[model samples]
Target: MTPADLGRPRTPSAAREQITTDSRTERFRARIKMLGSLSCQLSRASDLDELFRAVYSELAGVLELNAFVLGQYDEANQVVHVVRQVHSGTELPGGSFPVGNGLTSEVIRTRQARLIRQWSIDGPRWQVGYATEAEGFAQPESGVTVPVVSDQRVVGVLSVQSYRAHAYDEDDLLLLEATAEQVSGALRNLRRSERLDSQLQRRVTELETILASMADALLIVDASGRIVSLNRAAREVLCIDDSAILFGKPLSHVQWREWPPAARAVADALEPIIEALGRGEALREVEAELRADGRRVLSFSCAPIHDEAGAPFGGVIVFRDTTGKREMELIKNEVLWMASHDLRTPVTAIKGYTQLLERRLTKGQATPELVANFVGVLRGQSDYLVGLLNLLLDYSRLEAGRFELEPKRIDLVALVNDVVASVQAMSEGYRVTLQTPPVIEGDWDAVRLEQVLHNLLTNAAKYSPAHGLIDVRIEADEQSATVRVADQGVGLAKSELGQVFKRFYRVEGTRRLEGTGLGLYICQRIITASGGRIWAESSGPGHGSEFCFTVPRYSRQIEQRCPRGACCWPSPACWEQVSPRLRSRRAQA
Candidate 1:
């Protein structure tokens, strides 16, 4: 009171101006404080949802926010998604709405702050639709809606309301506009993070899918030698049916699993890969094969895999079944040795005979008859050599998988009669008899089949005693035509029956016979390749053996399989006119 008395009196306008100035300064400080706190809050918000919550929290700090809708604007789609909504003293639901629907739309379209002294969450005055329209939610007495602008464009809308009329003033509008920039920053950051997360997930799925489909049985181990991953083929190759047993097991325990004989043999062979892990070494294509009793049964390889920094982490173990390859190699080696020795014998004999003939002529001891006899012997040896060469050529063609057939229709009866006649002329002792239907016919390779028949007949004569008889039967049915060559010769043992068709195999006593062991093998190949099977039947040794085979038979009623060079048929289209029943029969044949 004493200080007031001593002070000089001023005009009312001056006092009023001073009070106004103080009030403005206080508001400016408060505004600065609110904006600063909002920036800090947004910086710490984790995602769009948290930032939305932060925006409303900041608004509550500076003004009365009774109700609000925080929406993301999609201008291209002309829609507003009310991503978050909060209200006091009213029930209102948030969702998508058309851009031009209400007060929220007004702020988005004009890109300016909007004020409505009185507003409803529903009805004609409130244009934007909400989920609470059917719930009869109350209206806001007053509100302010503003665009949340960032980077010179509006990204979304921020609206606040109060239950009291004119609850939001100019000061509230200014504060909300300033705080919206922080919200905008958060939304963009969150969207970027989500996109990155989605891309990462997709890449992981692609990698897993690729690893699962690999053809080779693959196994992956970690730095600690723990089994971490395996493919479907691994389960098959290892003969394991359960994944739980394999996924977390150690590489050291692979041999202990109940592996199949083949897999166990591989695990035993792959010791090199296991030892490399302990030595901190990397291996690539470490080829290995597993064998039992000195015979290769399986083959496989191992290679190390590296991590991101090129550090050794694991290895890939791959396996394969190589039984067929091993068998083929053994057969090929045997064939080469036998062929060389067999071919050399004939050549060596011919050389010796020529030398003797030359010496006899020079010594004046050569008679004309002796020279003629020597020439005849040479010719016979040459013919035998030619036959061997031909057999070898046929074997080569069949082994190389390139044998071809020229099929034609023929009277199998005529073929049997002609072969028997030829055999009778060549050999004096063996009497060959033929039994057949008068006109049994079929599709067959004439030249090759004739060779097959000739081989059977000659072998029969060669193995039979002098004056032995050979019975030949040619028979046909709806399905196939069969040829039986029964010889009264030294028959085969039970074991010899199966071995007779093997390459380089001959009966025990028949080794001295004038025939290479390749004849029956070649005949088997030809007969089997022509869609027939050849087999031998016998009681026991010295009794006799019957060699029988079958070739497919088709109806000769409408279609006859004609020869390649000469067609005995009237037209090539004769097959097209066959009856349906015959067509089905031929197709089955």
Candidate 2:
């Protein structure tokens, strides 16, 4: 060796070997640099398509630029989806194909890299042809195919082909394989992100559906007390038709005083509840009322919403209408008050008369006339008490759905005359005149019918002026009989017409009258259960009122003509024959 040749090979073979080693070292360093560049590109990609495009751009620098195919393997279906394909440096449409004896499938099946150096001989053995080539492209003489693996599983395949034979060597195969492995990790992450995004979108849709369908008013506020969202019911309760004006605005910004009287009343009631929620205090079932229109009661609940860290983020408020419940409670209190007063008055009268009688008898100063008079007074008071108790019993039975009726054939005119005579005998200064058909027979409970008539006549006499004229009119069709009782009395207001049939409900002006408010309710129940209906009508207060009801008219043969499986009383045909008004009322009952 010469002194200048210290770093040079001594033999000819050694010199060639040293040159090859240096070249291989340089190529390895270049491949490592390419890999680093690819990693950076993959990380910057926002989605799967972008990541795949990045992989293709990176691979183009190191491989033959003739043909390329990037495919995702479907293991269950035994197919490969060509997601990206290029031929002669031009992009081609992608497609899918069944797994077969192709270079791509071999790489996927073996999970190994494949290098085909020649086409004519090696391609025939592997059955590689147009089936494996990109559409409108010639078969390649040389190619490298590699499996993309992640978590020790083969997920896809990557291939690059060249028209010239012996284009790809072992080094090219290794480079392609490394690139595929890097792509596998990126593909997995992109798919996972896509799944998460889809799930989050679905959850948002479900939450919106639930909020829209909720019956209670729901309001969501941000940390600064600004309205974030609200449900349909919340908008209705607040009387806000266009919610855009309120969203992102503070709850205090609502000009409650400018709203309609009823809505303003409700908003005023909710002011304190919202204030408490702003203070981060939870409240439940706080009640409020709106008295501007009719009485309406509402319940409110509020809670502070917190993040996973338990720090307060916002609050939610729910409002539920409880008007019906509060009204029921008021009616119950009224009934108890009226019942006590009515019972106590009669009992007090009876007790006073008995005490006087006892004293007079003890002193031997009671005469026959005096004794008889005392007995009569006691009996009248007792009868009143019994009648009151019976009214309560009937109401109880009706409420329990246990009230029953016994139907019998009877003359409608005679029944009305009998009820009118009885009512006139009991109440003075009330002239009740009846205009009816001479003979209209119907299947009905005679006792219950009389009770209904007596209640109507007494109610008319109690509310009418002195010597008021009450007209009882009866009409009949081929199917049913109707009776109408009208009186010149302090008529009910329009709002009170529908409520008059409800138990324990009384008109405001008639509260001072002697009634338990169950007469009309009982009458309604009896008529309704007998396949009939009752209703009240009036122009307005002081214009007089009318009560009308109808009963189906059925002969013995018609009553027995019910269908085999029918459970209803007078057969479907009988009901169909009645007036439309009667059918509508029965349906409502």
Candidate 3:
């Protein structure tokens, strides 16, 4: 018997019921198979379009549908258009659905499934050409649409059309609903993944902007000793031509070999810190030097980078350019050495000549005029030599960090008077006078202060024209004391004022004037060391000049004593060990 003959014929109601059960079962099995295949396709899909095409094709093939279309909403264009399509017989016309225009629109608008059993009624009624074409091919007399919903809103619709009358049943609706659920879950996941990707891109852009603005060179290396990130300054300093070559590539391959010795020392020192970090110790304030492209760069620091769990991931190095400052220090040292040598040679010769004269004269071998002449030359050269020696000693002490103060109470008025008198006594050519305040007390190095006053007085005298009046003044207050030495000498040039206190710096116009060029510089150091400051002022060239300095007040009382006949001891070594009783009696009387 044929298969159709062997099967028993059924009544209309029984056939209808049997067909409904079988159709429902078939749809349920098809959806299950579609879900299984689609899951694999979803995992393999690299992009949205690929996933959409796979989902659409798999659903259409498994369901045995007449046509299938996947629509994507064009937010910018305000339209819903098909991205993937499968047609069995008649071709779909451009697969597009306008907003609120067709059966697709009705399903989207209501967010509900719509079923149609007869194509002639459902297709023309809904004005959906693609569905009508599918309906005609399959002779579908009944159909159903299931809305794919995600995030409480309908994203799309999945429609299945049939040829037989009343073909769809409750089971078919349940199976289509399950398929819609899978598609909705995929859409939600796609949206989440896209948002995460966008956020990551924004964070990277923000970090890049911040790094570009830094002044010092900053480089970040990864666990494998490869360059991961570099600031704009690092790129410019190292001459990086390709970003790709730098990132993930070993730092040694870049310009590390060409760095200066100091920079290399910094790099070598950092290796230990990196090693320590690798061993799980946190490194902070680690200093390193990096040399790049033949330039000397002084890097100030290195620090380890930490991961989310506070594990050491890599290191960040920060460095600055110190070439200019280092070079300046070297030049200053060399210049100071040359100046000391030049000044010491002349001073030493004068000291030898004066000592010889002093020895011979003490032996009483010379007549009065000859003794007087030799004594005069000896005094003159001795003073010149002493001035040069004092300046050199003071400057050297400052440089060597050996300068210190032995503070004492002193009379500003008496000191000025003594300094002026001594300066006047040294020469008959220039007239010197002291303008005084009665008293002042200060904690100061008295000898250094005296030397400063003596140097200023000598400069004033030497630069003044014959018989020019040099005025010295002492002004005192609770907070400070100012001593001013005004001379009617050729004033300093405007261009020379700024450099007057620099060691060995002198005005070109003052070459004819006798000086070692260090007197003013030494004076500044001594004044500053004493918690004071000094400055010079001039009206103009050839007008005259005034030099001033202020020393801090001692806030202490001065000891009661009578004016001394002479405060300048002939020799410091002998004076230091004098009897206190005699010294006090001499000071009082």
TM-score of each: 0.69, 0.75, 0.48
Local distance difference test, per candidate?
0.73, 0.81, 0.67
Question: In candidate 3, how many Å is residue 144 off?
Answer: 5.1
- Candidate 1 — what's its lDDT? 0.73
- List the candidate numbers ranked by TM-score, top first: 2, 1, 3
Largest TM-score belongs to which candidate?
A: 2
Best by lDDT: 2
Instruction: List the pairs of residues colliding in candidate 2.
Output: none
Deviation from native of the Cα of residue 367 in model 1, angstroms: 5.3
Better of 2 and 3 by lDDT: 2
* Residue pairs in candidate 1 whose N, alpha carbon or C atoms collide under 3 angstroms: 101-127, 101-128
Worst 10 residues of 2 by lDDT: 564-573
Model 2 global lDDT (CA atoms, 0 to 1): 0.81
